[model samples]
Target: MTSFNSKKSLRRVSFISLSFLFISSLFIQGCKTGTKGIESGSNTTLEASINQGRNVFENSCAACHSFERDGIGPNLAGLTRHLSTEEIIDFISNPKKVIDSGNKRAVNLQKKYKSVMPSYSMLGKEKLASLVSFIHTYKDVPKPVDINEEGILEDPIPHQIEKSNFVVNLEFSFQIPASNEELPNTRITKLWGQPNTNEIYVCDINGKLYRVKNNKPEVYMDVQALMPNFKQRSGWATGFGSFAFHPDFENNGLLYTTHTEPIGTKNADYTLPEGLSGQLQWIVQEWKTDNPKGKTFKGSNRELFRIDMATQAHGMQNIDFNPTAQKGDKDYGKLYIGIGDGGAVQMKFPEVANGKHSPWGSILRIDPTGTNSANGMYGIPSDNPFVNITGEKVAKEVYANGFRNPHRFSWTNTGKMISANIGQHNIEAVYVIKPGANHGWPTREGTFGINTQESVRKIYKLTEEEMKDGVTYPTLEYDHDEGNAVCGGFVYTGSNIPSLTGMYIFGDILKGKLYYADESQMEAGRAIDFKEMRIALDGKETTLLEMTNNGHAKLRIGKDANGDIYLFSMNDGKVYQLVSEK
Candidate 1:
């Protein structure tokens, strides 16, 4: 097992690499440099180039070093005084080589900073020149705006993206009884509960579900133990994934889970091609507790249904019960499962990408309460979009199709389902998922058309009619410039934070940035103008990245019975509740 510290280092390096790749791609396309100097009109052109460089710096270098003061790396303010622009570019591109060559400044800097500087080898000459230009012109570095006494950003950036009104506060720390120590910093994927229950249930990527009561966690289930061949890859597949309690849990004591189960001696619903070995299949099982109101759980488990995962990652991740669907309703007692395209990306497999009969790339709705079915242990809802269709390869269980990885989806109290679909490489999108909606996965990423034959960075606009048809474009989407992973959030209806009430809040797992959109606008089928959730710790402005202590572990959003929202840091075993400004 990789230690926590080593994982953090790996993530830091990975992020820097990704940032350079993204910014370098930008540089190749747009950042053509002209004559560069600090002279007046020269300053205008230079500033434009510098601004482009600044974007790269903020996204890549700013995480470690700042211009104002020493951080992970030495302060770059007036760095030109110590090194020439050529020397700086050389160091940025080849820090290890410079340091290893026994260069005095490089050695001294390495001595000053314990961590080794990552090399931006991927950055080509022009991009390096632009970065060097920004450093050369550095003046007094502008500090990040601090939070006011009311916990708002001291200086709000003008325009659409404003800071959030609320801040994140640690709710509790999990201590496992068996280990007799705090659990390792495993990624917490979901925090959920049954209706009218004070207790909260949290799941880790390792497949341990914990029941928290009085701020302590006890093992509710070891989901991994049940699957003999549960496969896991570092930083890729989620082990336990997610679970949802039946809305009538108080009476039924039933809950459901989505996980990757290895194909053992038992027959699998599907399997990888002949060459593949030791792969896992998606499992959606019904687990019933002995007492639904009890603090601890003793469960009886039964297999509801299973599907084969053609891809190692992007297996079934989210499962939820629609809170708005009541008894006797067509949707009542139905569970919604979100499945990725199973690696149909870049049209790796045409069947996975274009086959309507395949359930690999869609949201499936099924009646877990009923056992009557052709092959599946659960009942397929008659109202499913593909259920009635015949003579097609389409799986009858599909509710909605055409999403890459709908990692998380939730239904609001008002019956609206929202999804945060993880993009292939460039975009992260949020969608108001309508029944039978096609989100355009292999064909599109965000609003851009994807070439099924080859992956291209450029995005093409969808036709007006295509946007109006069954295909739904993103309600809100951000390019890779903003974030990579979109963690879906809930619509707040809680009274504790009146300002946050009726707002749909979400965050980026990689950047730890929180954003919210007005719920009213979302319900009206309009795109949202998302604003950043400005957070302050001890009156100092900060990002969720600083709060969580790990940048890569996903920042998950959660909700309790009261409708109050919470943020769970997968980096640390701490749960944070979103609260009103003190």
Candidate 2:
């Protein structure tokens, strides 16, 4: 009886080993068949369907399912081994129907996984078959290849700087927005250009300067040094709001900057109390760099001029050396500055002077070489609109009036000055700056009716002519549905991307999409045609590449030293070069 039992146990062990070998052979055969089918294109229809299925899976299913790990849904390992193609098709088409029918696998899946699977019935028969075939092929998936071990580097590595005939090595280092704190919060408000080096400069809301070199970045100047008192007081708002390098920066290390001052007796507005006086105020200072080379920029520091600002918030202090004029000429030193309408809405002693804020809400054109105005700072240009006007107590420097907060204004490639004004509740607008123009703000938002009556009693009242003249209509405007705040962008002059060339690229800070407006579109005075700009990752459109922290897209579309388009993600601090696949 013992010998018979031993023989029976050996037979049972042999049968089990045979069964395991058979299953292994079947898996190996399936893998071989799949590989051959993929190579020969024998399963072309199925493979194409699989590719389509993969796209749908990435966009819709990848969020839940994983082959090796269970995420929102169950792991799909060995699914093909148990379910037939017809059954999978039925289940995928309507998972609820299968579960209701009391199918063993469906009922078990429903019990084990409380979440119900969404139906893919919209995917018709042929497409469903392709997806099923793709699933069947993945039964015994191969391990991912180790590219480093295999010595296959497919993507273009940044370390390798390839030469190109179309490349243009621009001279000046581009400017990036900076903050006093290590983490920058303010958006880029304006951008200016420096001569000879062709370098671009940008000013942020917090008031800091950063220079971009070879697509890399470095801090150029600290605002804390200029506003020592403000640094000691707020510590938060202590930075240069804007800066402009002299046209002849090579000879004269002169530069100008605008910033908020420590609040003494007055707030951001210049309203002062009786007998209680505060000297500290927001001022534009002229400074010289110790280093004229501008390359190392280690120990550069010098003072040139200063202009006291009335308020902090609405002050649009942007200075730029006239590009049209020649450098080194004494009379060629002209600076254009745009100030905002005095602080918060209120009819106060200083704010209601002569029925308007005197020098506030106007553009000032000044000559920095003369010795007529404040120490170091120069007098107004002779051509200023209000310079010779009598009986009116307007400052000689006032060029235009009625502006609220002119965040940024730029000269087009053709030299046309365009300004973007931040609106109140209804609209944000873009305007062409005329020498004596009055942009209606506070009184009106865009071309809409004035915000007058008992509600806005404290604000200035507008006449019929002034109401019409005060409001400047935007060249292009979009509702808040499009974007919360607008970030102005430059026209693409990059050689690598032809489709983007000659198009003005601007974006909304809240929305990560880059909008392309053609020059012709703007010239026609019509609505700008826009499309959602997409980034390609491994030859596919993916949200993973676009989205950042909290699903907020922080996109900085800028140009490289060679005029090639490069995008930076503020959240990840990663930079990407745009390339077209041949």
Candidate 3:
């Protein structure tokens, strides 16, 4: 119930309180041989296998992995130093074999990343060997970075989150078409029902917006087909990030969308000062359709703004309107956009994500129809927190600042804005954001103070002399041991599940596990205790991981006009409706 307040110096595997769940991967190095450099022992390094491996890596592995640094998957640069070619190939084919072995190092790897690297067993031995051969090229692992070796909690929240009294039962309701042929067959992000109608709309990262009728989806808008320069890389939330319909869609038929373009598609409005490399640009576009009720979109598009990022990996996640706002309310029709740091701080360019005006690490509120912004494309609300501030290029559109990745945001019944912020190294947080409040990123994670200069990966106790003031922390938080990423959910207003009414239900995007906090009990400056929500699949006891071929869940939440909730997997393109609560 305390106010917004409050790890170690280690490489990717910091022994801090953050809990990782994915089977610890690459425990391959802590073998009997110790940390000696390893060499591949197979003849599979032929040119063909290497090239095929490269292709497979781009299409499959690239989404969660890389050689230079850590990602959702472990950095592969030094992977060969611990395990031989055969061992790695075997692990990649069926990672669970080693994960299930209960190796201390292996389990810790799971706890560190809190994510499972999908097995490539379907590729068979030939492709698997090729992939390992390709990975073997990066033989030198970078030395671990452990900056401050003091005041770290091995387990952040030592006590287990209690299980809820309600068990949600899911029924298979519908499916979106496949966006790709690999691990995430579908790249759906949001599935929201149209206001005052039975119509439902969903969007995919590969650039398709679908309108569902009678449980069937038809293409509503195709951003990729419409824009030739549109780029969609597998990782880092590039391409068709999210979309929002104007509150007056029935009359205005105006829709807004966020997508990405290649690094140099054009000059960006939010460009880095200098010396920092610009990876890509996250864009916001406004579209107008002549017919709002039509199945196919017939519209014209206009670019609202483009933001340049230092690197990939957290550009834009979601853009939405205040659903609870009525037509005449001041909050009505104002768009809330979630903008991430774009890996700038971790890349050592803290300046890009340093302040509110930069717009890299903040939640922005704008009037889509107004024209008061510097760019003249949108309106900075007259009452935006930073609107009247003078000096140093102020981004007047910023409502609240300090978020690494404000992945999702939804309003509670009381008009409180709850945002789920995906963390770095440790802590996934849910915050009750207020205007101008800084949610401290680069300076803090959850309640722990982190030194960005020394090591972004390590944590230290919050010290007044060592930290800045005015940083707002999360009302609800969990370490990586519980889940890697937070997929936001809404405050259920539907009548189907009376128990869920007034409750905010959400889940882990990586683990497909469910969680919730009663919004009725939420109050100012109070720490909310959330519990794990149990689920049943189609009348049978099951988990989201069990419902998939791979161990990952790639989970996301959605809702119908009636306020009933829906669960869908990004891995398989299937959407499930909440049928009952027991």
Output the number of the lDDT-best candidate: 3
Candidate 1's displacement at residue 67, Å, is 38
| Candidate 2 local lDDT, 255-285, one digit each (tens) | 7777655544223323333322222355566
Global Cα lDDT for candidate 2: 0.46
User: Per-prediction TM-score, please?
Assistant: 0.70, 0.55, 0.88
Clash number for candidate 3: 12
Scanning candidate 3 in windows of ten residues, the lowest lDDT window is: 1-10
Q: TM-score: which is higher, 2 or 3?
A: 3
Which ranges of candidate 1 are over 4 A from the true structure? Answer: 1-184, 263-265, 270-278, 456-458, 463-469, 523-525
Relative to the true structure, candidate 3 reaches a TM of: 0.88
Error of 3 at 417 (Å): 1.3
53, model 2: CA deviation in Å?
A: 53
Candidate 3 lDDT over 1-582, as tens digits, reads: 001100112122111011112212355546533323223344554666777866555444323444555444445566556665566666766767777888666666665555556675666677666665566666677544222235445566677788878788988888999988766789999998996678889999999999998899999999999988988876447889999999889999999999988877887777765456666788999999979888899989998888886555667998999878998888999999999888767755666666575688899999988887767888888888888887655777888888889998988666888898988777888888899888888788887877777656566667765445778878888887788788888888877777777888888887888888888776534578988988898677788888865667889999877778899988888999887888
Q: How accurate is candidate 1 locally (lDDT)?
A: 0.63
TM-score winner among the candidates? 3
User: What TM-score, to 2 decimals, does candidate 2 have?
Assistant: 0.55
| lDDT tens per residue, model 1, 124-206 | 66777777676556544332221122321111212335665566433343433332122225657888754576787888767
**Model 2 error, position 81 (Å):** 63
